[model samples]
Target: MNEKFTGIVLFIRPHREKDSLVKIFTREFGTKMFFVRGLQSPNHPLKKHLIPLTEHRYWGTINQQGLSFLKEGQTHNLFRSIQSDPFKQAHAAYLSQLVDASIDDNSEDQQLFDIFEAALCSLNEREDARPIQLLLQLKLLRRFGLRLNMNSCVVCGSSQKIEDFSMTHLGVLCHNHLDTDPNRMRLSYKQIKILQLFNEIKLNQLGHVSISDQSYKRIDELIFMIYHEQVGIKLKGESYLNQLYKVADQLKVSKIEGT
Candidate 1:
């Protein structure tokens, strides 16, 4: 049965020599593996559409149980901007890996799909990828079953006078509740606001995504702490991005010293 569906290529892998398997997260059907014959052949027609981080409208055989197959497909979005830029490419890869890990096979989640699609579009359109990256990461925490308490103190549920972030409480902490967790992370006034903003960010209607360098660094520290202590998922995309940042920083320092 041939059916058309829109999907994003999460990753691709080699199958028995010359063949390949693509894991695609579809709007209609959560995630499925598509087997392609002669994918590595010299003149494969579907080669361009099958690249990672690209979305396509595919007419493939739908399988409820095992491996499905792709007949043909068309480009849904080339994501040309992301394709051309390394940082954006890294963000796309990281988001794709996060989305892939957070969902189950063949499970339809319209909310997850919609936000993820929006994030991809936002990433492709925006000059700064960090904002979108942070938004998506904060949004996906609920899906990962590690929702942080942003509204009030996690210990006493007090909404007033929220002073710091408690890693032990896995949420915010009020001034009164600070001693409850001795390891609470002290957040500046701006850092607290940005965390709330990120947690409540709307992907499709994003506007003027801006944060100061200092606050942005602090926000990442908080988000990363949650992932490290609670979520605990390590991704190759993240590892690559870290290395890329290191190289970029080194280059900047070298340029400064040479001047």
Candidate 2:
């Protein structure tokens, strides 16, 4: 049967000498792999659209037992800035990897697709993209039905005087419930507020919110810990992103010292 759908390319792998296996997360079909013959050729028509994070409309033949065959497609948004900028590219790659790891094959999830698209767009356009990336990770976790409760203590349901985040409990712990887990990470009130805001606010409005360096570190660590403990997927793109951030930080320090 032939299927037509709109999707964002999540990954591409070389199938053979000339053919490529393309994995895309589609609005109509959750995640599907297509075998594009001669995609490695310099002149392949669909080559450009096969890039990671590129949104495209695709028409392809579905194989009952194995890989699908791509017939044709047109790119919707190439996100040129994301492809050109190293920071954006790393973040975009990480997002793509996260989506690829989280979703199941051929399972249609329009909400997840929308979130992924919005994340790429935000990263491409926003000057400070880390908050946007962090927000998207939280949304992705929620979409997977693993959302952490920031409103109150998961153990005692107390909202007042929340002081720490318990990875074991997967929520905020009030001062009274702090002893429930000796290993719970202490959190400042401001950090708790930032986590709550991320949960409540929409992705596009993330630009308006300012995150301090400390808050960003706390949130980043929390999100990564949740993914590690709950999701159980190790993403290579994340390591690359960390390296990029380290380099960027070093450059910033050097520039400051030189002035």
Candidate 3:
């Protein structure tokens, strides 16, 4: 009684003794857990083969409790670009944790799986990972039913060019729309345009657009506010990027004020 499927390792944990419990997001069966007997043993196939984020074609079973054992696993590329760079590695780990936290077991969503696969591959191959990260977050939120309106102001439903925008209420609260939330983020037209572009453009096409340093800061704040409201958890990766920008901002201000 066994089932065979292809999956990507999302997370792995050591089990009792030499065993390990591996969590994988599979294309056929969605997220699942498998207990690999003697996974740590030198002779075990998983000992040298299995790793986080590695794609594997596995033969296992869905028992009463959960999936168990590993008959065979063929490992594909380990994404050396992600593994080699510290920043990329950290971002990949963060993305993996987010996906692992959000995706549920025994549910198959091929679209979501494809999006995640595309995102990981893009991050590994892309020269700049920021746009890919942004796109992934947006797509993930949308898949979870938290859709933000990029085409128009959610309050006024105006398709007109938005001059001033806010993210507290999860959309472009236009100039006339009163900000009920005190923490509503006010963004420039350029910031809104970049966000709109990010929503529309493909990862490879993002290189065509140019965003200013000031605009990126505003977009970062808007994304943080929007994602926090939707997910109810502040992303440390966003905070880390914000801190770096904050330091640069302080330096810039110091030079301007000669303090």
Per-candidate TM equals 0.94, 0.92, 0.80
Q: Could you say which candidate leads in lDDT? A: 1
User: Which 10 consecutive positions of candidate 3 have the poorest summed lDDT?
Assistant: 173-182
Q: Where does candidate 1 stray beyond 4 Å?
A: none
Q: Is candidate 1 or candidate 3 better by TM-score?
A: 1
lDDT of 3 by residue, 13-118 (tens): 8899988998888888888788888887878766545788767777777653566567787776578788787556666766776676567777887777777777
lDDT of model 1, residue 26: 92
Itemize residue pairs with steric clashes in candidate 2. Answer: none
Residue pairs that clash (backbone atoms under 3 angstroms), model 1: none
Which residue segments of model 3 deviate by more than 4 Å?
178-182, 202-218, 234-259
Best by TM-score: 1
Q: After best superposition, candidate 2 residue 195: deviation in angstroms? A: 0.8
**Alpha carbon lDDT of each predicted model:** 0.86, 0.84, 0.71
Which RMSD values do the candidates have, in order? 1.6, 1.9, 4.2
lDDT minimum window of 10 residues, candidate 1: 209-218
The better-scoring model by TM-score among 1 and 2 is 1
